[model samples]
Target: MTVILLRHGVSTSNVAHTLAGRSAGIDLTDRGREQAQALVQRLGSLPIEHIVCSPLLRCQRTVAPLADKLGIDVEPDERLLEVDYGDWTGRPLGELISEPLWKVVQRHASAAVFPGGEGLAQVQFRVVSALREHDAALARKHGGEVLWVACTHGDIIKSVIADAYGMHLDLFQRIVVEPASISVVRYTPTAPFVWRVNDTGSDLSTLAPPRDPAARSGPVPGGETGNTVSTDNEGVEHPDSHTE
Candidate 1:
């Protein structure tokens, strides 16, 4: 199963350089709306079977265009919500940087907990758990390779990517998930493959499943001479193949 993590478009809080956290009413900027609409063209043709997003208005707005285009309902998942900045909610980033805890958040995020919010490690756990649950459910329902989207915040996307790479939560800051970008992860029974990260623009047609079922097989040991898609026992595609 393939899960595409999409960060919400630029928000008013983003323009103000503030942490919106779980606050209500933060919306996308005009340019953000344009970015949201562009997703219709970027992902509309893909074989996306389901769409899930953060309950926040920003994420909801981001995936709205694409969901409408694909005629799919958008399901909001709380686990996909932005990090709970708690007391830091709506505070300026510059101001937050001056605090002592800021250093811990940057260099030792696994142990860094917001004054009244959740820890970065907690954020990673919830989001990753949600993703695995959804992936398993979708794979069973589709009974084969499946593609889906999860529209969320930048930090949330970064955390997921870090987990996919088997990196420590403290190093998640090194992964940049820009506003409205898309990162892809293919989950297999054995491991997860990080196909693309923070991809803002590129052709995505290659993500579609091959037309022939026979084309879905594990990669060649030495190298792949042609396109191949690997499938597991349950019919879920594994990222073991090398496409040329």
Candidate 2:
């Protein structure tokens, strides 16, 4: 089974460095829409049989173009929802420290929970369960010819990948998930293998930048991570009130 995790394109929260925190209804920006188009064109060449979308606007928007290309509707699932950030909603990392359980959450994700939110163990339960079930369904449906796309947020995607591969959160925190990027994993009918990580729309094989001396390379340089949609995290909440 082959599973490709994709972070949604740019959104309002990305530009402000604030927590979206399971806030529903955020929409994709113009550039984000374009990024989705790029994903369609790039991955269009691959034999994609199914798409899993979070019940959020950014994810739906991100997968819409790809669904058009595949001639299939996105399969929505509530388990893919982002973490509920509770009191930290709309606040940036700096201000988020003021939240009640921020310290515990930052240290031991498994033990942390927002005021009115979920714990890391709970988040992992749903996300991981969703993934396994999706794998089973896709395997039965497509056999070997399957490319499943999951439109999800930064933290959730990171946590799913990290937990699946047994990576430490420290490394997970450093890994970035840019807008409309493609992170790939493949399990050969038995075990899972993460073949690639956070590849942006700009990294599309067909549209990837030329290997020139000036080509922007190596982790996309810090401070340049912000926009309307993007981030480097795992086990985080979704943004609120998206539209697009």
Candidate 3:
């Protein structure tokens, strides 16, 4: 199955430079709505079978244009929700940077837990597991060949990319996911392939309809999971390169 992970467009909090986290009432900005519409234009041609988005309003607003254009309902999944920032939920980024916990968040995030919310590890587990479950379910539903989109938050998207690359949570800081950016990952029985990361372009015509329909069961001879190919975005095991 092919999963397109997208960060929601910029929100009101984004322009204010505040940590939106899971805070309610944060909606997309006018430019954010335009960005979402641009994303729809970029990916409108793909045969997207499913659209899953975080329960957050920002995410819902981000994918709304695409969902409407494609005539597909957006499935709100809490697992795709933004990380709970706890006390830092609505705090300004400039101020949070001075807090002692900020150092840990920037350096040793694996051990950094929010004052009253989740740790990076906990967030990673929840988001990645949710993605894996959805991928497996879609594979089963579409005969192991499917195209779906997951609209979520920056940190959530980064964590999933880190898991795909098999990198330690401590190194997740090196991975950057910008708002409204799109990343693609394909999971097979044997390995996973990273297609695009934080890409604002790429129509993704090369990803749809399964490169080799039969390869969904296992690695194929001249397809995505094949060892013979050495493309940058080809199948890569974890810990080597987190984002291709």
Candidate 4:
């Protein structure tokens, strides 16, 4: 089966660089919508047989445009949500960077979670578990040739994909999932392999010469407009990220 992982669009929390993990009710920014729409224009043409998302409003809104475009319903899964931030939810990035624990988390970034937040290992276990369940379903349904999409947070999606390739937590920083980015993976129950991880809006290459550099600098015609299409939220995972 082939799985595509996507981060939600920009949210209010993202504006301040705050940790919006598991914080409820946040919505996508206008730019975020444009990004999602761009993704829709890019992938909407694919035979997207399945879609799962985190339940957070940002993720919901992010995927809604695509669902509307594709005429498909998002399958919300709780297990795919962001890891809980504990007391760190809604905290500003500056404050988090100042704390000693945050420093430890940086060094042991993948292992040192917040005081009350879910551990990286645990988060990986559950998220991968959910993924495996889906894989089984897809394998059974399509004989292992199914294409699926799971929209999730930056860290949650990154950790699982990286660990699958023997990458360490400190390496997590290297796999940056810009808001509204897409990561693709192809896996089988027995032998799994990662195809691509965390490709951003800038990575797309489909184009034809319009003979105008100025026009090329802007969003591709009939493509998503690029006006800071990100959102403010946990910058990480969501509870309903399956929105699960």
Question: RMSD to the native, candidate 4?
Answer: 10.0
Lowest lDDT block of 10, candidate 3: 235-244
Off by over 4 Å in 1: 210-244
What are the runs in model 4 whose C-alpha is more than 4 Å off?
202-244
Reference-based lDDT, residue 58, model 1: 94
Residue-level lDDT of model 2, residues 1-244, one tens digit each, is 6678888888766756677767776677677777788777767766677789888888888889889988988999888887777666766766766666766665666777777777767777788789888988877876433567888887788777776577765345545556676786654444565646776533333222223422222223563311222323343333322111
Worst 10 residues of 4 by lDDT: 235-244
Instruction: State each model's CA lDDT, in order.
Output: 0.81, 0.67, 0.79, 0.70
lDDT by residue for model 4 (1-244), tens: 6677888887777775778889888778787788788787767767678889988888888888888888888999998888787888888777777788766655676676667877776777789889889878977887536677898887778777776677776666566676787776656444455545555543322222123434334444675433223322334332221121
Question: How close is each model in CA RMSD to the real structure?
Answer: 8.2, 9.2, 5.7, 10.0
How accurate locally is residue 92 in candidate 1, as Cα lDDT from 0 to 100? 78
**Runs with alpha carbons beyond 4 Å of true place in candidate 2:** 168-171, 201-244
Question: Lowest summed-lDDT stretch of 10 residues in model 2?
Answer: 223-232
Q: lDDT per residue, candidate 3, 1-244, as tens digits?
A: 8899988877788777788888888998887788899877878888999999999898999999999999999999999988888888888787888899988887887998999988989999998889889999987788758889999988888888888888888888787666677887887777776767877654567667546555455445554443232223222112211111
| Candidate 3 wrong stretches, greater than 4 Å | 213-244
lDDT at position 202, candidate 3: 48
Question: Candidate 3: which pairs clash?
Answer: 165-238, 165-239
Backbone clash pairs in model 1 (N, Cα, C under 3 Å; residues 3+ apart or in different chains), count: 0
Which candidate has the highest lDDT of all? 1
Error of 4 at 86 (Å): 0.3
